[model samples]
Target: MASREAPSPASRGVSANKPLPPTFKSIQDVLNGEGVAKGTLVSVIGVVRDLRRPIPTRNSGGSNHGRGPARRADQSSLTANIDWKCVMTLCDKSIDDENTAQNGATGIELHLFCPQNAMPEVGFRDVVLIKSAKVQDYRFGTSLLSNYRTAIYVYSASAIPMPPKSAKDALKPRPGSKASHVEDDEHEYVSWMYHSMNKDSLPEADVFEEQANRSLNVRDKFSLLKDVGDGGFYDLIVEVIKDPYDLLDKATVWVTDYTENKHFYHHSWDISNAESGRDGDPYGYTTAFENPTTKGWPGPYGKQCLQLTCYEPHASPLRSQVRAGGYIRLRNLQIKYGRNGGNLEGYLREDRAYPSRLGFDVIQKSEFTEDADSRLKDLLKRKLEYKKKLKQQKEAFAGLENTKAVGAKRKDNGESATKPNAKQRRKIQRAQRDQEVQKEKTQKAESLGLNKQVRCESEDQPVSSFDRILNGVSWRRTRENGEEEHLALPFTNIKFRANVRVVDFRPRRLEDFAAGRKMSEYDCLEDYDGGSASGSDGQSETLDSFAGPKTWEWRFALELEDASPKAKGEKPERIWALVDNIEAQQLVNLDAVDLQANQEQLSQLREQLFKLWGNLEECKRHEYDAHLESIRRTKLHMPPPDSSDNEIEENGPEQAGRRPPDKVSNKPFTCCLQQYGLEISEADPTKCDSGEGKRYQRVFKIFGTAVR
Candidate 1:
């Protein structure tokens, strides 16, 4: 929704308050016996930012109200305004060091440094909130320990709730009404949160906790932060607003009892700002917005913001690129979350060599079934190929062999009796064997379909892709079974790393279609980024820019980081990345055993489909047989009677009378039913019939609709 508040009409604007520079602060820095009054309310807005000497008493500035600069140096803390009443309440009331741990809004609040007169003399529920905040210069020793605490400030104001109003409208005190204290509209409650710490009592222990091995979801991941510390390590979250004037001084409150909010993150609270950070309250600190909406999540774990205090160089960027490293680590990282859920966890491992293709086999163990039929099909294929080659060789030498045998017999001139008998028997036996083999081949071919004559009688049989592979060259490999096996592995036969280069390609048109689409190729060249994904596992990266296939240099050899490599002095890299094919890459990640399982599963699926097709063919064959048998019997039974003719004769006449004339014949008919061998029905020479239905529908069932 668009904001309801209009822009400020004032031509001249006050220079917003200056932010405190980075410096150590003590507890005494937030406390003052000087600004205290009985029942004085304070609202929390901005953080009680850094500790620095005040900005030289505001440069002795003129008020722009026609007055010159004041002589005395004014000492004040910085303050920002807030919209929610709940934040004001928390900041105003929770400044006491004891209350800091219990306050709902963690370290994010607005702070003001002003005197008692800031509140109008009602000691009231709603008063004018403090317009400015003063930051105190924090130095070491006694004050340093005190500054370790989190503080809030509140402005005193009368809150007579009538209805929820705009942040702009809510700033104005309702005129003439002494107070707004409607019981239903006013809600105040608080809850306590206890932060657990490590055995060392310091807040810097194992922050990246893997709940049963680092949680795969955001909620589960963040839950580990609680164990970081038990002491007063505050996670201060600052929500940003564009201009500070938009939120300057409003009355707000906070109850000791907190109403639970579902959206709290790492002690960050979402309370109404009017009550929690309003002026008259005692405890709120000030933090300023560097940008319009200084939106940020806690970095790493338990880190509310980048601790400029810990940073050696204040100007360093959040991200950097390094040429070569064992593992590039992010000490602290905050991931964004959306309305529904977090980003899905998906892992991609690419081959450094080839980019276009991948090798894959499904690894659903329970879903796999043994493929007995595919094995059988392959067996049959081998047999057919062997028989074909044998026949070809036999024809090539057929006549020559007979001539030589006959000539030898003649040369022997009435050869030995035993020889003649042996020759005759051998010829007969050879012929008989050939006939038997041919018969078997014919039967096998016939069994392949729903009908007979699957193989052509006069034409040629077309060789399929499957048949070509079976008859052509094949590669074999030795498996773990101590037996030779057939394998179609692309990497085993073809070049991998040297012949290929992995390039992450994205479609250019995708960005045009989607404005927010990420529009660049991601670097997916393997080297596992040198195990950069999961830290160093003794794995170093090998950077090899390949020239051609199988020509990788020995100097850049990658070896196992953990286990010693086959070659010494080689960098350790993921072999999974060396693979060029996608499926092969996945198989490598899953390991060799998984690869076999996947192939087996695919083979099983192939077998199941083959079996199903076989069963369907058998069923269809039986159906055709039954259909043919009926016609044959009808023709055989009566020299004149055909079974297909009788049923149609009666049904055809009835349907034909109602349907429109046929387009071809110009005669109304529902069908022109014809039988292959059966005699035509005598009643209606032209067969036509429609199924039973209402008159209009059944009338034109053959051509379906007769709209006219």
Candidate 2:
């Protein structure tokens, strides 16, 4: 039988403060002793040869696979209990590599089981020091299982510190695990193993390289998550529902293509803990709901999402590149049943042996071209339907609540006599406060007396309000389900004439209204010096004398507030419209130049803006200075600079009003506002960080209208 080697006489009777020497069993003895004792606790030290990705040992939900028929109120509820399992193969020095193992060398597998958050990270070729691992017989061979007392320490080959330096600095405990400590005597063995492994180039590295290249040629047919079956490999295009949670060797992300599968775990929000018989509910109950796994689960609820565990090379990219709400195409996703055989989950592993021909380029954007692919279109369609269904469910639940409240009310008094619960009362209070706030904002910006002060270029056109321009004009189309849907073409060549007041302007400072023109399309304007007009603006004057090129252009944005009366329940609307060089020159009636260098043009520009917005600039400057002073006082750890305009108004009738009111007069004027989509990124084949760049963000622009 395999036994732990004893400590030498010199090692014994050491200092009481020091840890005792560790005893490790050999591989041969541990396997041979398996028959003599079924479950044996033994510690071993070996070189890690291979690693397998973590898999969920338990399903996310209880045994009721929610499918076929709607679950009744009396039906047994489902609860989630998820655990993780990871496996790795360890071999003695007698077996150098897998090639030698084929010649009949021995190795034992170690199975580690813990909760997802508690799982430790072990990687390939590291020397592992496992203490008190329980040995058991499995499939005609011996394997080790981790217990509560089992601790693991890793001595990485590339990171091990050499003598006379202590290995204590180099040893690291597996992340998320409370493993046993390494004794002082064990440092020499660990260092020796590290040096010996690095003495010669291992065959495993070359083997992995060749296998990775081979993996690039293999391909699989694309299949939706709903159609995927157990033990099958298929490619999937999915939208990540939540941000990925990363561990040492793997990453976990929840994703869905908005498809339904019968075998998927059901997430419920109506079950109670007493009914489900689950105790210590650490995730706790959401009101009356017993959803332990999905307490704050973002919607498209029920069985729509699948949990995916990604291993190694793929995990790195998934952590760095992917984000919530982004779409990705996962290659060769293996669908398999969990250890309990009750639920289906996804495993994205990078197999070192017999790799796929396509290699580690498995994770990429679903739409990798300039245009959306057919599959991506289908995914979007399904996502829309899912959103509609979720909305209907919320509406139905709200209607039911209203009906209950009405039925319970005292009609004799024509009032809701039934008192609301704490949660319901808070919800009602929030809604009422929001409505009042919106009403105040809209009333403060109404255009009653200032209409005649300013005029627009397009005087004959009927004026629209900012709200009308924002909600946009849309047309109806029939969906596949025979439901009519209102679709808005966001970037259509459409223009609207609206009456608005300039409440704010961007580039913050008036002197930063112009910027250096880009030399080429590829120039990102990174060298523009952020409109700081000191050195660059003066230097540009010198360059223009010789270069004979237009060096500056106007680039700024204006925040416009609606000047019309807001309808009931309608919030105040504000939109920022970019004023490019061409439109800007027309508005101010002045050609572009270095505004800082020419004081006359700068003063004229200010006069033009004063006509457009009255004393709005003075009010803005006052507010900006006050904010800066407040920040400065905060940095100095002093009390705020007193402003009677804020304190007297906010502190109520008790406080004396000493500060003068702000002089702000913004005249309402009509303008031609055009709605368009701005290309945020240009399509470049060289960059693959995101999808083939067809990314366009909606933007509004001020055009045609000028200061007359």
User: What are the per-residue Cα lDDT tens digits for candidate 1 across 350-421?
Assistant: 223222112111111111122212222232233233335444444445552565777688668865655646
lDDT values, one for every candidate: 0.23, 0.61
Among all candidates shown, the one with the greatest lDDT: 2
Clashing pairs in 2: 215-356, 215-357, 215-358, 215-359, 216-357, 216-358, 216-359, 217-357, 217-358, 218-357
Per-residue lDDT of model 2, residues 617-690, tens digit only: 77787688678867887899987645664565444557455443377776777678888776566576553222
Least accurate 10 contiguous residues by lDDT in model 1: 189-198
lDDT of 1 at 125: 24
Reference-based lDDT, residue 517, model 2: 55
What alpha-carbon RMSD in Å does predicted model 1 have with respect to the real structure?
33.5
Error of 1 at 36 (Å): 32
> Candidates' TM-scores?
0.16, 0.30
